[model samples]
Target: MPVYLSRTANFLLTEEQLKGLLKRYDINGDGRLSKKELQVAFRGLGLNFSGFRARRALQHADADNDGFITDEEMKELITYAAKWGFTVN
Candidate 1:
């Protein structure tokens, strides 16, 4: 499914653009997202995920199990979010 409500907007983003947008949540610009960063990212998108739910998100998206979401891993997250009706802002 397309990631945004406007089908045309979905066509506007390349995977690289989408990936770069996810990195905006990396407050430290560390090239990865921590649990806390993930929390803010979710909050920014109006998602109420936190606590155990946030941890679960990290686990699902942290493909390397490194406790952080890399740029590549962010794709998994974006796909999952799109499936759940969430879109990157």
Candidate 2:
């Protein structure tokens, strides 16, 4: 499940990382995370989350809108997170 995100070769996440993020944010267990779902999930995990912020992050990653973010999407998301100073782990 690890995905390679190439952007100056600085941002990449392994499959375990992806699974951790999914398990952290996939509150609904629907295999995907909506804006609200992400918020709830993160918050439940003791993360200080904003729905709008998480939405933007999810939108950046969920390219196919297939509801769930694929491994590729997760890679892109890591890149974005690294670029924007969001938590990448």
Task: Name the top TM-score candidate.
Answer: 1
True-structure lDDT of candidate 1: 0.68
TM-score of candidate 1 on Cα atoms, chains taken together: 0.71
For model 1, how does the per-residue alpha-carbon lDDT over 2-84 read when each residue is reduced to its tens digit?
24523223244555665666679899988988998878776665556555545877878888898998877877877665544
Off by over 4 Å in 2: 1-15, 41-49, 84-89
Clash pairs detected, candidate 2: 1-15, 2-15
Query: How large is the C-alpha RMSD of every model relative to the true structure?
Result: 4.3, 6.6
- C-alpha TM-score for every candidate: 0.71, 0.52
The residue-by-residue lDDT of candidate 2 on 1-89, one tens digit each, is: 44443422446677566457556666656655667765665455344445655777787888887655655676665565555433454
Rate residue 68 of model 2 by lDDT. 55
- The whole-model lDDT of each prediction reads 0.68, 0.58
Q: Assess the local accuracy of residue 45 in candidate 2 as a C-alpha lDDT between 0 and 100.
A: 35
lDDT of 1 at 44: 63
lDDT of 2 at 40: 67
